[model samples]
Target: MGAPDYFVILAEMRTGSNFLEESLDAAPGLKCWGEAFNPHFVGAAGRREMAGIDIAARNADPLRLLAAIRERTDGVAGFRLFHDHDPRILEHCLADPRCAKVILRRNPLDSFVSLQIARRTGQWRLGAKGTARMAKIRFEPADFAAYLDMQAAAAAAVTRRLQISGQSAFHIDYDALGDVEILNGLCRFLGARGPITAASSRTRVQNPAPVSQKVENPEEMAAALAELSAQEPFGAGRSRSLEPDRGARVPTYLVAASCPLLFVPLPGGPRARIRGWMEALSPGGAPPLQGMTQKSLRRWRRTNPGHRSFAVLRHPAARAHAVFVERILYPGPHCDMDLRESLRSHHGVPLPEGPPEPNFGLDAHRAAFLAFLAVLRGSLQGQTGLRVPPEWATQSALLQGTAQVLLPDRLLREDMLAQELDAMARPFGRQASVPPARTGAEATLSRIHDPALEEAVRSAYQRDYMMFGFEDWRPEAAG
Candidate 1:
């Protein structure tokens, strides 16, 4: 309609969103409120009220504040909405065609590193003095993986909502934040009357150094980033190709520095245990080398002669259940809240509105898992509009994707994982020990194991079953 009644900037932390807000505020007849729906404050940090609505009042009825922002501003009024902000405002804005959406994105690695530095230094913004505090932070692969997952989930949620609603957002990237032409164009999109001659200089770049300089462990950071690039080549908002074929994801390949062992992981398998086993085999129990490219992988092969690459295959039903519990059912960094909501509402999966209650037991979990399996069938076949996550994709398909680059030298079944690993490690004069078995989802699956669940998994992952010769899922048989 008429330039949308107002606008909302859908973004996450450290994405140059604050700079964007400042630029928009500098434009004529355009007003941008800072984090209007941030749970901790009203309009900005340390502020309790906005447009006569206190934090408590805003929490009671967020839409009331939205109305006030629109009514009080003399011209076009808008605000920022982070991924972790109030859900009610997000829901309302996404559905309301009158609310123009502007999405701001940055490299997840940059944002993650920036966020870490910010947390360490407690400097959210910078001035022209450029007298910013600097610190070198260690890069933890596990933490970065979680952060990537969260960013991906947030982007996917907004994207799916816009897609389903048939709405479009004005997308911008962090690098373009300083471009005057792009900022002016954005101002025009927001119905601003005057053109901005220059980008706002109020907020300076806090961390001007390269990522390697800011991180304490450059090698580890490089490895983690390489892994991230291989898994998500295009960052958080990577397009979902419906070709039914995936890339080899070579960067995710793990190799032992001192040993001749390479691990090609199939997501949702016993990756941690495998890593642990591989690490134990390394001299002095060192971590495995990760974040390999095709070129680097070949170099590694040339250097570490006689290296053996291996992959583990878990039963389709067990793998799917693990993915469901970890990535769909539970509320965690790995969980996709949007997908969970869609399953509960659109796919007839009887998931609880929020976290499962203490009373939610085997029966509830079984019913939900069965329903999820039904949806998974469609998802794998491209019938569902959702992207087929690697966590639950058929192992056969994943292996096929891997074969596009390099096939594993050995494929071990989960039931025989420990024995096979021990045998594999024996050549290097080291004995590998498998970690303790997971109990939560495994125990729950065991309690509800039946013919129906097995049938559902078979229907959903016929390729894996046909290729692997897996029988019905037996908890006792699992690794």
Candidate 2:
């Protein structure tokens, strides 16, 4: 009944975080709020009042608000923190001895699948809802790999923070959630007294069966899962150390540039075929930036001075649509759950009333897409927190900083990829035939045919329109 000590539930998506937190909250003299620092969570009026602050103050000075919540709580006070939460709050929480840390983990494969199911069904937690929605997700190796790598990175980051602060944390696993002993152990870790029993988890496991039952590519996923489980020293797979640098732009097959062709890669652009043509120019060699270093990057820059450098650009509306369908609407690891959360939390998009149909209604998808664009617009205007998926980020923003320093000589339109490739080739007296540009077959610009959504897209990517000479985009519905 005094000033309460604090504790955080460090977790990732679909890691039984809700279950763990609910169980912990049920204990006497302990309370763990859900992702208090999450943009969406913070903006909720109910959550704000619970924290004893208004939404504006919470956003303006979250650290103070976080501290206030801890001070105001009746007993042990804490909140859930994801890898993508506000950094300032996470830093303060780790640095404060009054704040205990509980790190939660789950089988990466299971977690990834659960996340996809929840996203597809819009049923994040349990209810009297008669049955769980079953979704058949076509598992792609790349998507799985990316998901594993991302989750691993988030865990490693928290470990690094703990190490820097010389702090130790109580670790819990998703598999241990239902056990009364495990629940009690968590309570004890939070300085609770007396015997505590596990509470019924507020959520249900969406998929309780083998991975093969839900996923199309179960064999590959199983092999990858085995490899991941066998990993020792943890968080070791592909070396993504370079991911922060140049936005994952390691030169592909386009290393040998006859004309100082500095091909700045754009995610979700025509990078694949462009690189393929570069590979055609020369095969059976290590691609550019394959083993690149900071020094090597500088060397390439120095080596390519006075050469023709270019990047391909896609219409912002088209790129956003493609990213939404291919990444967001799909059931896979690459789905941008964080972005979706931000849209709901910060942008005021209403939560869906029911589980999403496997093939979502076109109007529903369009509204969601509009919400995403709204968040992106905020990010473009220097809003922070939610890490915008690079694939859907405005080209103008992605090309800033080091990429900006490399100054592109030309920006090729995606629709004219073939024409642009031939032009670059003609300058060198070599004809390079390239494949046609790729678009989202499942969804297109027409998805957001509403005038309002189209306006949002235009506002979000205004810079792209002005810089790339894309005619002002109006929704087909408007016309």
How much is the lDDT of residue 86 in candidate 1?
Answer: 98
lDDT of each: 0.82, 0.64
Model 2 lDDT, full chain set: 0.64
Task: Give a tens-digit lDDT track for model 1, residues 34-80.
Answer: 99999898777899999988999999999999999999987889999
> Cα miss at 450, model 1 (Å)?
0.3
Top-lDDT structure, candidate number? 1
RMSD of each: 21.3, 20.3
Candidate 1 wrongly placed segments (more than 4 Å)? 1-243
Candidate 2 residue spans exceeding 4 A from truth: 1-4, 43-49, 128-130, 223-479
TM-score of each: 0.50, 0.45
